[model samples]
Target chain A: MSGAFISFQDATKDYGSVRVVENLNLDIARGEFVSLLGPSGSGKTTLLMMLAGFESVSGGTITLDGKVINDLPTYKRDMGVVFQNYALFPHMTVARNVAFPLEMRGEAKAVTAAKVKKALDMVQLGQLADRLPGQLSGGQQQRVALARALVFEPRVVLMDEPLGALDKQLREQMQLDIRELHHRLGLTVIFVTHDQDEALTMSDRIAIFNHGKIQQCAAPREVYDHPANRFVAEFIGETNLLDCKVSENAGETFSVTLDDGSVVAAHGLPGLVAGDRALLSLRPERIEILPAETDATATGQNRLAGEILDTIYQGDHLRVVIETAVGQIIARTDRKAQEWPVRARVMLTFRAADGWVIAP
Target chain B: MMAMSLFKSVYATLIVGFLVAPLLVVLPLAFTSGAFLTYPIPSYSFRWFSELVENTVWSRAILNSLLIAGSTTVVATLLGTLAALGLRARNLVLSSQIRTLFLLPMVVPAVVLGVGMQALFVRFGINSTYLSVIVAHSVIAIPFVVISVSGALGGIDRRVERAAESLGARPHKVFFLVTLPLAMPGVASGAALAFATSLDEVVLTLFVAGPNQRTLARQMFSTLRENISPAIASAAFVIIVGTILVALLLLLMRRRSA
Candidate 1:
């Protein structure tokens, strides 16, 4: 990225003797919405806290707009942080809570009132300005928190699992709302969440974290369609990781032999060589199941003959488990397609480009 | 279940009677028309209550008690709130031990504390002054403030403070605007308790106060040693009613805030 807006250079964090984040190096271009997606204890939230100035960097520098601000106090960082619990002042009315930052900056009373009204209107909570936070619903309080964070117009906004407390429908609605705000206001945002769907739906790039390190960082489609490693493959969505040994390593493609002596062609990670052990990551949704007697074939497609072990009827799709020569492979097919009974023979086919090889 | 409930009701009545029996005996004496505190044939009147306000000695004692208790509330609340805030530090070594140290005056015998405070105040050449009395009273009153304020401070979500800081409020502003307002109910209740403690205090007052600084409780003690007057009963009546009123006010404040 040229002229990065915020960068963490070899940043490390330790709590007592336990290192939570180790030598993290990442940069965000201006107005980019990046998400740190990981499971619990993966240090995603820790990285966000460090950038918010709530936690200190144990080593290396975190520079913002070309200025190293490792030691700057949270109040001077000029960043808005929205906590999962909303963290609104319980005693203050919604209007007063939104007006607090302006008051702290010693803005004139009339100006503060006008700005507070504008913020409340933005969140569509202007009618509830006089209500205390305790009187509002969970979603309403979240909107108030969002309004307050944006009222200061900070250069960057950091949200730590902001939608973790909401129901599914409300959470999706908030995701779209936050994404729209990020675009309309041109706000630089760093969101931390464990939900891959949320990260994919909102962020320009998703940084997959595990065991205190980022495994991969890329655009949503790139990460999902071509995961960098097994962790990213399984964590982002459902996938079948097949054990394979490299039989041939061409420049752009490689042929691997599965455990049952079935040869499968797939894209390799450049480091693969012939006879090396590698895992093949195949998405369940990418495979198509055809009738046993059909002579349908396509270019660049890998095929395997198998019997239908089980068929699970999902609402929109059918999940068919096949006992193939490679292993037990699971494929998702459209629900409207022809149904295959258990014990019936079927052919599974997927493009070689869809299967990615990762080092074992 | 019926038998258990009957037993519980009887046990409660016994406890209530045991506590109120003494007040009932002493309060009716405040309405006695007779000069001496005794039973039977004494017509009811407000004569002693009138004498409480009219007599200069009793009036001055009331004034002194109010002045000392008021000042003690201010000093105790300030010091106690600060101590509670300091103890809120994470990973504080021997935290419970430090809290125990703050509460030592609550359990230590009042006579022992009075003796030590008298010697300390005399060494500082401030004995027998209103400042000495207020300071001595605050020593015992501070523990209540600490207990209440620390409990309130504990209930707060620390992230709320961080949110304020992230919004560009400095540490001091975060405390004053966010923390202090939220913990105000505790501070208020603590102040009321401190005032009550000072008003009821006698042993400590006797050790540190002079004739000019005589308080109502101290005057009641001295008057008991000299002679039993209806004025003493009236003073006790005033104190019991005042304490209950203060307690009610504290409860009402907590309810409204909650």
Candidate 2:
């Protein structure tokens, strides 16, 4: 990723009495694929629209390549946009749709033709160029829209759930295709989506927003493995939140006592007393299950224990639901393991490094 | 279920027939050989149709009506489409209110508008002229154009316009190349309505038109007052058929575009 090519300085948008987005600040590097990930009404799409110049910045400046673009009209910004519905020009053929931006810029006829052909070839929709948008399938129309956006070779591209209208299979395929296109072109992309998996799969960096503010922004794995806060952890993926009280304070690690009178070591925070309440996030797949007679004693650095209440046989893994002394917990195991039946006595254990103490 | 649907279908047919009965009565009467405008014709002939084409006064009125209606259609469509574009956004309360005010000519009784325009045109000393009639017709027709074009604009996904803008189209270029082309069907329908309104207009034209500026409807009105001529029925039939053809053309255009 290059240095900051687009910056939002305290951007705000208010729709009369309701504030859709409030005081948002972000710096997007050139050639970086950033996904604004959030649930509905989280203002992710609103922020994207503001960057695309569709919506105005009510109280802040949006600088593109270090120049203020707050007063520039959307057309003058020289950006490309792909909409969720694909927004292909219904009146024009696919080739014509792809040629529209070049036509707008008054490009030479021969150059526009070559660029349109190259764009269509990039999306693998070259044969459908003569068809009207209505005559093609949904996925084909989306490719035409993509081709139209890319033909101009704009520096930045904004996508608002571009694959939202496709089915699961096509959506996944398009995600990989778009990601590859971004890698090849080295064009900056700001994608908006509510799907965590999609964001994790495509983005170089993910910004998780809530209540019109970014809760955390980092690499995809960083966000998933080392979330900055409780909201970020819960929003990224499933986690078992357990309540604990601090029992010992080391230099950087804290010894916390779980509800079941078990002591576990977690790495976070300073200035924590022995009696301070904290929340621990435990990943399901990180927990390992041992045979009943084998692990009454703590093995290596494992502490938790539970009896298997049920086992769900997924094709690739087994989901084991356990009833522990503290609470009900879930553990994911490989399907190759010996089948654990209902009501089997089991010892569930996980590394202290896998669980982190999050401030409540 | 079938019996109930049959009864509903019959009821709807009766209502449609009742609405169309007046127009049906005038259509065949245009071909009646007798001088009187009675139904149950004694014989049929083309005498009234020939009279309609030969009469200089009625022909001139028809020509004037066509010219005025054509001009009204062009003016109303351009202004109405522009208004639709200007007022399509969720904001712009004042512009929307002003748009509602433009619809006043459609909702208000034509007599009231005619009286008001008569006063205004008199003050300007242009009352009862072709200019006065064309202006009045435009006022009446603009609301229809506005309504149709607005409907078309509403049906379009506004994101497409934004996409066009992001693709480097200036505001005016976006409107002309992208927005106007998408909304052309609505503009066409609106223009059709405007032309029909101006062509068939009688009450306002009677109040505002000079003798030389009399439209086909006004000419038909005067002919009825003097002596009931089959030529009046011929003119009515022509106007009705012309309106239907224009309306059908609009529907066909919509379907083809779809």
Q: Candidate 1, clashing residue pairs?
A: none
- In candidate 1 the C-alpha lDDT for residue A47 amounts to 94
lDDT of 1 by residue, A123-240 (tens): 8999999999999999999999999999989989999999999999999999999999998999999999999999999999999999889999999998998788889999998988
- TM-scores of the models, in the given order? 0.95, 0.95
Q: In model 1, what lDDT does residue B147 have?
A: 96
| Native contacts present in each candidate (fraction) | 0.88, 0.92
Q: Give the TM-score of candidate 1.
A: 0.95
Instruction: Give the lDDT of residue B176 in candidate 1.
Output: 92
The deviation in Å at residue A87 for candidate 1 is 0.9
TM-score of chain A of each: 0.97, 0.95
Name the runs in model 2 displaced over 4 angstroms: A248-253, A269-275, A296-298, B94-96
Deviating ranges (above 4 Å) for candidate 1: A296-300, B1-14
